[model samples]
Target: MAGRVVRPRQLAFALSHTESLTRDNFLEGPSNETALALIDSWPDWPNRIMLLSGPEGSGKSHLATIWAEQAGARAISAHSLIDTMVPDTLVTGALVIEDLIPGTFDERALFHLMNMAREDEAYVLITARVAPASFAIPLRDLNSRLRAVPVVTVAAPDDQLFRALIVKLCSDRQMTVDESLVSYLATRIERSVAAARRVVAELDAESLRLRRPVTRALAVEVLRDSA
Candidate 1:
């Protein structure tokens, strides 16, 4: 015991992964077919203004990116909306306002942007966790405009899509997971893309620290520890 030499444990570093948001990278399933169709419809949209809604990590941003690429749209955050920026924001004749929340952004700026887009026949794509129609916007005209805009909602992932998402998330982290681990995670975790991303990230970090391969046993440990 006196001669025992203890090796230092490995340090798990947090590295950033750039996820591909291109059209080819998006996974299609029943949950998102309608949303995909809406993007593909493009200029033929029911209205020049459209609202894209979904739960977090439900691929709303991804679909928005695809549409933006096709439409040459400029992307902006809802919080950054300003009355004076409305005209310049739509220079490309298209815009994407991401992560819009009620009461967080300038209601007047949005109202002005909507009117400007309508006047110029520009396309505006708004992404939010919930539909804008459901938001309690104080601006009466803005509320009416948002309610009239066509809404496309992305639902939660199905079984096949869930498994595919787990695989994709793991691959994004450069972790090679087999079916057993995938199946185990699918049943054990919440059925959402965000949940899959979180669990896979945790497992990867844990495996690196422990110097162990990712497997069902490792998954059990990670899941339990997180719980």
Candidate 2:
């Protein structure tokens, strides 16, 4: 008992960090160029309604925030759509409906919103994980309207962007990581922004738990244990 090595108990701390969603904080890369361009085009868009499609954590929300700021748009989740609130939601002449999952939101409310937006010449930006055209909407008219909207897909990040994302994610957590850790993670983890965020969070938590710095060795163990 006297020679036993005591391990530090891992305490869960609610670490708070602010992620900048401003336009200046956005990282530009080829994977999201079209999506970013669409947001920048703003009132000059070809259509009053458009859709942004990408996987989870693909910066769809961030782009929506940027467009919302520029266009003076109010942001709301698709699930909150009520027929009665459509008018007030579009008071700014622009609106962003985020995380629209197929068959989850009310069809009538969406249809009414689209019709009113058309009549009022208001802009609507819908963010979904997949193209809205692929959604199996029960309302034929609503399906037709969704099919007509232009869609921009955010592809997975490229190598340069992937590495940069890992670094940025670490910075967001206030972790002091060098190029060695960044390069090691780039090779070990999946090449996606979401994956980068997840691994960084894991590394931070593990480092805190083990009372060690975020070195390549810690990353190797964290990744191995996670895998």
Candidate 3:
């Protein structure tokens, strides 16, 4: 039987579902090993309060979501934390805040929320691309408090890890790729997981459009235009 053609929205949903957060879905490598170890030690942590920080596409948010699933923790986006009061939004266990370094001016509220979570003996994990020190935080108290929390940074992936990530992403998308092609991309594309991911996504979309399998030629063409 012929498989049904995936519409754009359907493809989007499929990709989202396949890439949904789990420790297994997170590609393990030297760069992220420390963060994974820290997350794995979550069971031993007295305060589930942890912070994961790294460059873009370093999988900080992905690991945060894994932490939530493993500990039955609540994951909340940054926008929600700003627009809504903490007590009103989070009434129970752990909470995660993503993108805490950029325009994160609502420090007083976050400071109070941290105390509340501590009082309740619940965990709070904040994930960001950069460390809190890089932000323009005016609250001295909050700055000191945030600094005390253990922060784990995900280093950029190396060539091997990048190749593995590309293959994993393609597999998750149910797309077949040749090893030689992955090798070509690993050497040619930008040296960031974010770049590899974007290239794969573009190739996937292009393949769907042209009804062709992704090859070295196609990859090169797509990357050149995008780069």
Candidate 4:
């Protein structure tokens, strides 16, 4: 699955986690502990550039934000990378450009940004579901730079992240459920971030239609329907 691409909704599902970028809330497990460590080892980055790659709902954006805040990095999207002097305007040496689509990115601007970052000993962190190798960057120099940058990937949500996601998604809707219910969902639901969010949203609608409280029974029925 090298250089794989995914849908936008898949990436947005990553953002379904709590809005807080506090490091304390970032759950650590075998799955993402390495990626977290790489971020924690920042400023000491080999090339002062890092690429945070992960599947949708893998919490890459959240981790990027945490790193950005700590390193005083300016954050922007790949789409906005072009048509603006955003990169040149960055006062700090650190930059975070997310959602890096290969063909769509502004080759010149991104190339300049990366070049400047290297020359100034600044840092850049990019987040995306797609691999940098998969991007069709036109600028030869930019392509070479991205190819050499470190791409630390966060794996799909682990069991701990799944359970945490269930709680987070429910909390987003102000719905309460027992731990047992969350555990049940963590086991039964699809092992993807999109599944976590979609199920929670569906549960709300299902409960409303049935005029019932969200319960193990309701979840069972909802999952069945979704299946």
Task: In angstroms, give how far residue 13 of model 1 lies from its true place.
Answer: 1.4
Summarize candidate 4's per-residue lDDT along 1-227 as a digit string, tens digits. Answer: 69878755311122343445567767676678888998898877766788888888777877888898899888889877864575464668788888887777788888887776767878788888877788777688888888888888888787887888788778767778988889889999777777887888888776666667889988988888778
Compose the digit string of candidate 1's lDDT tens values, residues 36-64.
99999998999999988999999999999
Q: For residue 203, what is the lDDT in candidate 3? A: 88
Cα deviation of 135, candidate 2, in Å:
1.3
Indicate which candidate wins on lDDT.
Answer: 1
Error of 1 at 116 (Å): 0.5
Write down the TM-score of every candidate: 0.94, 0.94, 0.87, 0.81
The local distance difference test score of each candidate is: 0.92, 0.91, 0.79, 0.79
* Higher-TM-score candidate of 1 and 4: 1
Query: Which sections of candidate 4 miss by over 4 Å?
Result: 1-18, 205-211
For candidate 4, what's the RMSD? 10.1
Candidate 3: RMSD to truth: 6.5
Candidate 3 — which residues are off by over 4 angstroms?
A: 1-17
Candidate 2, residue 43: lDDT: 84
36 Cα displacement, candidate 3 (Å) = 0.2
* Shift in Å, residue 102, candidate 1: 1.3
- lDDT for 217 (candidate 1): 94
Better of 1 and 4 by lDDT: 1
- C-alpha displacement of 66 in model 2, angstroms? 0.6
